[model samples]
Target: MGQQGRSRTNGQGGPGAVDGFFEYARERQLIKLRRDAGESPPFTGDPVLRAYRFCNVFREDDRTTAWFRQNVRDVLRESPTEVTLATITFRWFNRIEVGEQILDILLEDGWNAKRIRSRLRNVQPLVTGAYMVKTPPGMSKLEGIIWCMKHINRRSLPQMPMTSLELAHQWLTQYPYLGDFMAYEVITDLRHTFQLQDATDIMTWANPGPGAARGCEWITGHKYNRHSKTDRVAMMNVMRELLRLANSDEAFLWPEDWPRWEMREVEHTLCEYDKYMRAVNGQSLKRRFDASHQGEERT
Candidate 1:
């Protein structure tokens, strides 16, 4: 037997071995799925892989600050460790909240529209530095991008193009979350609507959700998943902004190739999707939705 096989047989690998094996199996399955789907593999580079590893590490030991220090802080070149540490420690805001705070700060600092555009690059680092230590599993790199864009849109900062609601709808479709409502709202409030062609492109790029939709349908006279034409347009705009943000070079530290590679690989695994749907349908609606959405996106 190979070392891995022997280790598993001897029970010497323990949970770590089992976990690694499962991960390997999952990747293999993903590759097969991509091949079957006739698609290229998704990208997996420094930032994307590192972010995934960091999230895994965080999940394994939520209490440990070492993960942040080792994974994120150590990656910085010229920044002082103390400064990085302080930045991580002092941050009290969630990803979106922090973006809002930064927008306020920039405005307060007399950053003009041009300066805001230039300084937009600084938002990622600032938010990353702040939330690196206590990163949540539900908050993805894409979410961070959306949050940053929302901040810019919310502030109506100069030079920032007006994003529409239809775009937001598309982005939220890919990565649904409770916080996305605010983003949707902002897009709806803005003018200069996107063309339907642009909206579809944004939808394709934004990768919106297949999960249960949530928002102001509660007290406000609106219904979830029952968006009006105006609402749909607004959502599309928001989604477009999210796509733009996500596709930006600074969106992630990982080599841009990683997600594309993984996405491509995952697409071929229709059997896996079928299996997941059959096995976990009753127990996990979210999983089912995710699998279905991924499958659709792959095609």
Candidate 2:
């Protein structure tokens, strides 16, 4: 934990020490949210998978059936790592549909770097979504795909090493467009799709993305200060305590389908909280997966 977290905990003391920042939330009775019953499938028994499930932010009013996301549920049975790397490479600064389309191109072209470049050379550029993606000048979307392919090829591995999820994050973020959030996302993907790491593994770590950070603040009334090591440690601590409370004898249980949460899942819960609030409250930035389309909003 950082100095900020330690100070806060020390001031509050005991169980409330970690949770005291959110006294306002408790006063407002914001902890318990009304979620739809059995909207999606129950989380698989796999601990890691359950954790990943908790990461996704689903809302009761969301248009669950509006879009068809074939790619999300599609698991690569063969050449998993190659496909995983290809998917992550194409995913950066792009929408889910766009990324899936790019992935199809790579797969059809046999993951051939030059062939893909040649085919996509004259391809029309696409504009979708609101955010600006920073890429090198003259780098077409196809070229971006190739850049990732080459990047992964140099490493000679499909997914990152499972030994240290944190280390894998460091390795992936060294790339041009891949940042901390994207890297953590890729790590989550590897765990969810290819079973690269266990959800309950002590070394496994999933940092909340921007959405999760905002959600944490809204729900807890505490700013999830991204730049502060103390804040980061505090965030993890609160998540741990909250999950324990949710399943404890005191009976703060969640929905049956909600499943027991792990650390990664707790990280996900915060992100989803951010998304739910944005949509319900009509924030300027609406959710990318706007219930009109089914997709993974987070990378």
Candidate 3:
């Protein structure tokens, strides 16, 4: 047997091995179901592959970010109005096509909600239908843009500092409709524009979204408590330990082509796993993973 077959029943496993094993099995089951139904598999043939061509679908690569920064430099370099517009476009729709269309309309209609609403009325149904399940009280997407404008224009509110993710996200959350997830998105975008010192370090402080919470619960066999900071820390500890073992043990080795995962990347992977589980099994744990989190943005 190769390392994988030998390690499967060795009575020893790395921290992430259990999760990986389950995921591998689940993927195999999915493939079998698809074949039985006369449908194609969602990804490649290998159930155990950690990284694939589709890995970049959810996560941003360095090249993608760099290209994004260059293209938006003009908008980011100008007045805070432009920054507000760009951030709102991203937060509200998040989809590039929808966001770009609304942004173009905003430029033509001016920053206020009333004008944008009037101009976008034709496509309002489609746009509004695409919004997540819950929204800020009495706040539409157009209103969200205006709210961001007001916050950005406020002289009393300090500019988002590069090093302080907490302070930046806190300020963003004070605005209506800008929850933790949206705040993190805005701060991440602004960080690209700021070009400030320690910008790369801010991701380490990022709050995991609802999907990530669910993923963590599933991966840890429903043992991780999302509400407890101690449990969150424990999850990170487990990931780190698993990574260490994967590096040393051939049986636990991840995809050779894949780069080392940062903690934030691991969190991202958990979120993707959550989506995958929902599609494949729809078998959610009895405990509520989302109860402890605030400012959730679910799709």
Would you estimate the TM-scores of all the predictions? 0.21, 0.61, 0.60
Off by over 4 Å in 2: 1-80, 93-110, 118-132, 193-195, 199-204, 246-250, 275-284, 287-291, 294-299
Give the C-alpha lDDT of model 2: 0.47
Ranking by TM-score: 2, 3, 1
RMSD of 3: 8.7
**Model 3, span 1-299: residue lDDT tens:** 12453244233234653545334434433433354476643433442222221123223342323333444434564444455455554455544344445555534322455654565555543332223523546776555455555554434334555456656677667766567776765666665454322455543455666666666665555566656899767766655553454334464444444445444555555665554444334344332322121111222
Residues 1-299, candidate 2: write the lDDT tens digits. Answer: 12343234332235443243232222112212212232343223222222221223322112210121234324352455554554465445345444444556545432566655564566555423333455557877666556755665534554456566666677777787667766665565565444354434533355766665665565456777876889877776667666665445554344434445555655666655454334334444443322222323333
TM-score of candidate 1 versus the correct structure, residues matched by position:
0.21
In the range 1-299, model 1's lDDT, one tens digit per residue, is 12353233222223443232223324433433454587754422112221221111111122222333233323331332222222222232223333343444322332233433454544454433312332235664444433433333222222223243344444423422324433332222121122121233323322122221121111122333424556554434433433343345774522355342221111112223222222222333222222212322110
Distance from true location, Cα of 148 in model 2, Å: 4.7
- Model 2, TM vs. native: 0.61
Report RMSD (Å) for each prediction in the order shown.
20.3, 9.5, 8.7
The all-Cα superposition gives candidate 1 an RMSD in Å to the true structure of 20.3
